[model samples]
Target: MGKKTTHKFKAEVSQLLDILVHSLYTNKEIFLRELISNASDALEKARFKGQAEGAEDTVAPEIRIACDADAGTLTITDTGVGMTRDELMRNIGTIAHSGTAELTRLAGEGKESLDALIGRFGVGFYSVYMVADEVEVTTRSIEPDAKPVVWTSDGRTDYKLQELDEDLPRGTKIVVRLKEDLASQFTNAAHLKHIVNKHSNFINFPIYVGDERVNTIQALWREPKFQITSEQYAEFYKFLTFDPDDPFDTLHTSVDAPVQFNALMFIPKHGDDPFGMGRENRGLDLYVRRVLIEKQNKDLLPEYLGFVKGVVDTEDLPLNISRETLQDNILMRKISSTLVKQVLDHLAKMAKDDADRYADFWRAHGELFKAGYMDFLNKDKFAGLVRFHSSGLEDEKGLTSFADYITRAKEDQKEIYYAYGPSREALNLSPHLEVFRRKGVEVLYLFEPIDEFVMDALSEFDGWSLVSAEHADPAKLDKFESLEAEDKPEPLSDTEKPVLDKLLARMKDALGDAVTEVKASARLSRSPVCLANPDGNVTSSMDKIMRVMSKDSSIPKKILEVNPDHPLVRNMLTILERDENDPFIEQAANQLYESALLLEGYLTDPHALVGRVQDLLTKSSGWYVASEK
Candidate 1:
């Protein structure tokens, strides 16, 4: 041995090491990831230096991991640029001192490709102390004159360094004497391979656990798009997500401005968490140079796009010392905005180019994607992508986008009309849609409870206000001519207007505070009555959903709009004309109000309405029998 020496660790270095071994990493297995990543970085530096010198016989770079269960030890060897004694001290003997960062600084004025280097915080290597009772590093520098050196440390207070007399191959080898408790976990070949595959599978260098190479999957996102085939993408996606089915769509994009990143995003053929049971763990696997920094990082994408699964590798992110979490949220937000735009642009292109495929995407993800209405930055793009069942469609299965609806809309239409109900059939039967149907106007059907909230957030799209049919103004609708002229009931004969007024007064009196106002509606053509929001504080759909959520059985009072032309209302007017003080009048008014409540999904109890129906049946049956006699 050439001279063996001992050195005390910097005070801060000792403090940081304690943190790394005790509390820094959530998963101790990632120590392997840190070592492999450092090895990869060394290998990349060697490759870049060789390429710069036009070297043709450079050694092929590879990482080899050997697990010795009997010895309770794990060894990792790499064919890369080995560290000089000075470099070893500067890189590993201090806290937050990074070899990769030093190389970057030295290559600053040169046109060097140092971007592949992964170690920036310098603390990653210390993570090995998490699983090791003692660690030894044996390295021989690629420089011909540099002597071989060995570094040994128990990772507590001090370390020893020695010059080796034996010749060794270029690069570094790490031998970890595993902690007694963690020996079996780290010494098993299969477990070691799993750790490599999980964190460093896409590393440029081949990673071997024993003789078998574990990282067989290529980093397709780094490869040129034209060179990668659809089959390859599908294979990679299946390998990444473990989804048996092929993706519905794939978005492979590289962004160079504001932030640089390689994103390989996929819209799965179907959502794995359709019911949102496992939605808590959502977002892309965040990687820095193909090393997974965070898995299912929820910050990578908005919650609305949680269904999207993929990998996002960015070198520009400033990671915390542990490399487990991001340090700068501003940079992350920029990346998020860029990703949102890319996804939106991809979907928009698909919608325009492949309607059938886009329709499939919509069907599989529309319920979740509809939550994007709150993404105000991309509101226009989101508006263009949302699909709805419209009155114009022959069946509920057919869907129309807002753009398509606007295209087919009458020139005078300024509002995009939508109504919320349980289903298309329910919406079709909605009393609020009577006038819209008469005017041959297309109304979007909102079936999901979130649909109302989505519309409320969006408010408007492409200069057209999104107005609920329940809130449609009567005068603006009357301006549009009826699609087909209907034989009209003459306005209650002029002399009978007074009787209709008396019936309205009687109905309002019967309803008491159950209604804000009881008034004849010019918009209603078929339904006897419908409720409208008195002051628009809450929409009918939202109110019903809120009530259901709170388990409140009480019905909210609203404006009752009665159609004078409907036969039910005309008959009620005659009933009032004959006997102004009849109990049937109050019963008939209450029955109409309750029936409207039932249609609006607000009526919790039907006992009174059912009894009234029975009484009406008894009276009508008796009258029919007397007529037959």
Candidate 2:
């Protein structure tokens, strides 16, 4: 046996211990996590040194944990590059060289770099004091002739170092005598296995709790992409996400400079709710050097990507002392920004290379992607992922993106036209689309109520303003001639214009506040009448959405357009010119306006419309009897 020396802890070491034992009371269970992480780090260093020295796997690297319920003790053993006597005394009893105090002071000052330095300072070993009253460490160096040493500390003020009586193996072992109150909490084999698997499951070396081995699965994210198989990837994804369906997409990448990170992310075949879920917090698991630091870490990704499931292992993340939360937010943002870009880039590639698969993904996740419409920083990129039912397509099976719309737009089409309705079928049948259909101009159909907000968020795509078809003026389509109507029809006769004007004015008077302005229709080639929003005003779809949201009963006014060529309107004009007060004339005019209101999806109370239709039928019966007699 060699001489035993008792040494006092550096002032900073004492101060740090004081905080761990008393001031910092949370995450006491993290002591196991910290110790396991330290063991893993030591194992990693030993493996690297063994490779450098051309040592041929002297002893298989592993970590073993044994819990002694009767003895009230927990011991962790690691076959790592053990430290020498001088190294142990300097590393355990002193903190001058590491300057943990300066790091703490700098952390208080909000110095970003010092936060990372603190993580690398190796002060995590002291966290054992949180659970144990006394700790003993026995170690022997890998050097052939170095003597073994034992270090003992109560983690209060000072520690003792002494040489072991006999030679020991090239590794370190720590035995912790738990406090009486804390003994029952941690001495169980099951609880220790849970902690080991929770935090250290990805450690490079095998970990054994008693005789059984834990941490069986490899950290595939840290491995090169080429080395993993599709079946393995699927299994890993199932393990991480508990999802049975194969992932629609996978993004595996490793970044070196600026930030060091390895990410293996998966987009599930379907999400929990593709539509809005009301700001639910969700994100990926975060790990540092194979040890999990935060599970479900929301800071690693924005809420827009909550549906994504995967793991992000980075060596550069600066963690707090407990490794529970991140320390440097600015650094986190940099990593997050890079991750977001990579994910988007991978999606863009999928969109470009695989239309069928991408379409499937889009059909499931398109609405969620719309949530990113307000993310100005990524709006342009996100726009490429937007899909909508288009008038140009015969069926709704295929969806068109804004980029596709721009490519197919007419040369003089100054605006990107879209129409919002409750469903694709409603938007398809909307009378507002008459002019576009006549002129062969395509209009995008938006179905969801939130689609309006999404369009407003994007505002414009490729320098072309997004104009709702319901709100578009007939004049906008004047540039494109109606392809079917090559020869224009005769205009309304000069003398008949007076009668048409009187009929329009009378119809406007009958409708009262409902009609903003009554005018001849240039848009309608088939329908008798239709309602449209006045120029520079909200579309009927927008009005309906607002009314429903606010629970308001009042409906907004819309311009009334009359097709003079239609037989119904011609008959009404004749009645107005002959006898403006004719009861049937008023009934016909009112019916015409109500039908337009119904078509616009704004007429909620059907009683008034039903009553008017019955009156018109009764009057028609009276007219038919008179004619038959």
Candidate 3:
């Protein structure tokens, strides 16, 4: 053996080592994950080289971890492309290879250059000292004639290099003498197995602790889409999502040009919370070369895609020195943007290729998925993905997208009409949809509270504005001449106009500030009365949502449009003509306005409306008794 040589670590390296051992990492157990990950990378490099050189039989690449409690030692061995004597001196002995000085400079300058240091610097090996009192490494290069090299460090200011025994394998092995208290924890086979599985379960090669293999689960994300079976995907999805049913869709993608990554994402057949969970929690696991770096990483995917669960493996990620979290927000954003696009693209294709399966996805996650319609980055893309109950498809299961809506819209239709209500059933009964149904115009039924905000965010789709049915002006349809001449109420007859005017004036007086104006309705065909937001920009749905959030109980003034042809309004006109001061006429006018308010979901107190309704019923029942006598 050559004489052992000792080399002093650079001043900066020594300082970094002290910090890494005492305070750099939050969890001491992470030392095992870091070291094991490094070993996996080395083994991968060796395998690639062996394939190119046709020397595959030289050694079987595997990672074996052995713990000795009595000896206070934990050793990790891997058949990998080991470093030569000179390589060891430069890679570990000097600070240059580890980028210690650069890291220190960046840290002193603040975190602006953090990404540069974390992504380019290689200092994970030093983290072993966080738990170990001393660490020793034995390595032999793939070259047959190369001598084995051994490096030892007490993790202070210096390290020593010596030659290993000739019979040592052509790989690298690290032996750590754990600190007194940490020894027992590191030596426990079961404990170490857990750490391995938690951080490195999907590592390509087999990982063994003692004689038992721990990393049995395959990293399916790295595999080709063509080779994977649906059964395999279903099994993997169940494991990841904990959902017993099969996934509605699976998006497995591999990209290399801009940012290299492999993603295996799944849309579950059902969601844990269909509406929303009221928080942004990303279900995607972030991995580097198959070793999980962050599990359930919220930064990996956007909040809108919270329902998607899977793993994303990429070498392009820039991880901090601890390898616990990502350091590059710019790179992470790139990955997230790409993922959002890919996932949306897959959904769009699924929607087009298979309507039945797409409908299944819609039923499962559609409520939460509508959140994407407001995503600024993908609003237009999401426009095609959103599904809604429309006048054209009255069935609850028959949802129409904006694309279909545009296709079915009447010629020269400049706006896409939609109505917001408690549900499809409620929207079907809404007075606001009377004219839409009568004219054969399709209006989207928005059921959720968030749908209004989503529409406001989207504002427009495919060059057409999203106009709310409750806010749409009746005169806007006159140009389309969609309402047949017979369908249009004979424009207030010269003689009947005065009676209609009298009813409007009485209603306006009774409602006071409750209504901005009470007008004759050219839109209503079957309904007695309806409320419309005169300020077209604010839909009734939007107003209600704002009211709830701001805790504002005061109702905003709305235009009360009364259908002149309806029996209720015509009778009110006749009653008003007979006796303007009649108490029943006042009760009747107030009832009309309150009922409209209730239908618009703006009625704050139902108590008053209920009393008015009781009064009307009592008066009508008495009138019926008199008629019978």
Ranking by lDDT: 1, 3, 2
Higher-TM-score candidate of 2 and 3: 3
Tell me the tens digit of each residue's lDDT in model 2 across 236-266: 9998877888887788989986789899999
Q: Quote the lDDT for 439 in model 2.
A: 86
lDDT of 1 by residue, 1-629 (tens): 87879999977677655545555334678678888988999999999888898987458899999989999999999999999899899888886544444543534534321112223444678878878889999998888788889999999999999988887888999999999998989888888888898889999999999999999989999999999999999998898888999988899999998999999999999876678786786789888888887888887788888878999998876432232235346777789889988888888999999888888888998988998878888888888999988999896688888888999897699999998888777888888898899999889998888889888888888899999988888888888899988656888787899888888888899999999898888878888888888886677888888888999888787999889998888888877888899898898889999999988877879999999999999999999999999
TM-score of every candidate relative to the true structure: 0.93, 0.89, 0.90
Q: Which stretches in model 1 have alpha-carbon errors above 4 Å? A: 21-26, 96-121, 318-327
Question: Which candidate has the top score in lDDT?
Answer: 1
User: Which scores higher on lDDT, 1 or 3?
Assistant: 1
Per-residue error (Å), model 1, residue 408: 1.6
Q: lDDT at 368 for candidate 1? A: 88
Error of 2 at 264 (Å): 1.3
